[model samples]
Target: MQGTVDSTPVVTGHEVAAHEEHQDLRVLGLITFLASEFLMFAGFFAVFLVFRGSHVQWPPEETEVELLLPAVNTLILVSSSWVINLGTKAIKKNDLAGMRKWFGITAAMGAIFLAGQVYEYMNLGYGLKTNLFSNCFYLTTGFHGAHVFIGLVLILGVLWRSRRANHYNDITHTGPEMAEIYWHFVDVVWIVLFSLIYLLTLI
Candidate 1:
């Protein structure tokens, strides 16, 4: 029997190879960028430590800055990182529903943490210009809050895109994964900031 048979789909080898190469380049670029960010933050931490050690009485003797609020915010941020990890894991498993739910929770927690920061600022007796302690506290925690805001934006973008394009699959979930990486970094920074700036008050 004479029959015309089409053996394969029409995608060219060059196209497939190009796509893989592009993905590899993207991952490498992200890692490089994050490394640079870590170095910059490390310098800030060094400065903070020097100034913190020089001060005999932190926040001065007259000012009253409660340590409990920032500690609570630290816990919230850390828990949000766990939620984000769950979302990323779900996306890798091709569980879109779970990913959305967990990501939403993570976003909410992050928002709550930011709100707590604002509340703490309101309650802080001294403004950023008042003293070295106030300046350092504001600089470190404010920088961390900005990072949290950016992370929330990234999470929202992924959630919207995942819904629109159904883009996250077992083989392609880099967006959520990268977002989780960034979120975890933010959480870790807060842990250090909280311990250095807040918990140290106890000792």
Candidate 2:
């Protein structure tokens, strides 16, 4: 009598059809989430515009918002977006060391931005209940700052994953790309917020 060998088929994630389907689903999900976020921010922007239009003195005579520090922080935050892209591009070129350096700098820049936000809040000389402008400024910017913090966490996670043995390469990385998109989104939101809150005040 002949004995039979036991061999079961293994299913790897490299199944092209399954992988593509998962990728499509993930991309669609992310877009939907970002769209909902856009609507929320739109509502806040509408509220700000309504209050600004109704009040003759927006910031009032006693309240002042200095533009220098916030502007510097904005530059830092925006620059981080550029820096992290360099990391992504570096990995594309198979330059792991360069990628790590750029990502680390990007994370540091994010930290500096959050620090600047905290400093600004402490020295603003106004409370959340100060006035409509102050209230909106704190609320909108505080939320943006929290998102920046979350982006930093995401960047750090990418950095950590990059250390794994043979884990990521230029064509093989999606997690970092997603994190980059999120950081860029945060940067864009800050730009809009800066225009509405900081630059508008200067005018």
Question: Please, what is the TM-score per model?
Answer: 0.86, 0.86
Residues 65-183, candidate 2, lDDT per residue (tens digit)?
Answer: 87999989998998889999998898888788888898899999999999998998899889889887888988999888888898899889988998997677866767777778889
Over 4 Å off in model 1, which ranges?
1-22
Best by lDDT: 2
lDDT of 1 by residue, 78-118 (tens): 88888999998898888999999999999999999999989
Query: To one decimal, what is the Cα RMSD in angstroms of model 2 from the true structure?
Result: 7.1
RMSD of each candidate relative to the true structure: 7.7, 7.1
> What is the overall TM-score of model 2 with all chains considered together?
0.86
State the number of backbone clashes in model 1.
0
> Each model's C-alpha lDDT?
0.82, 0.84
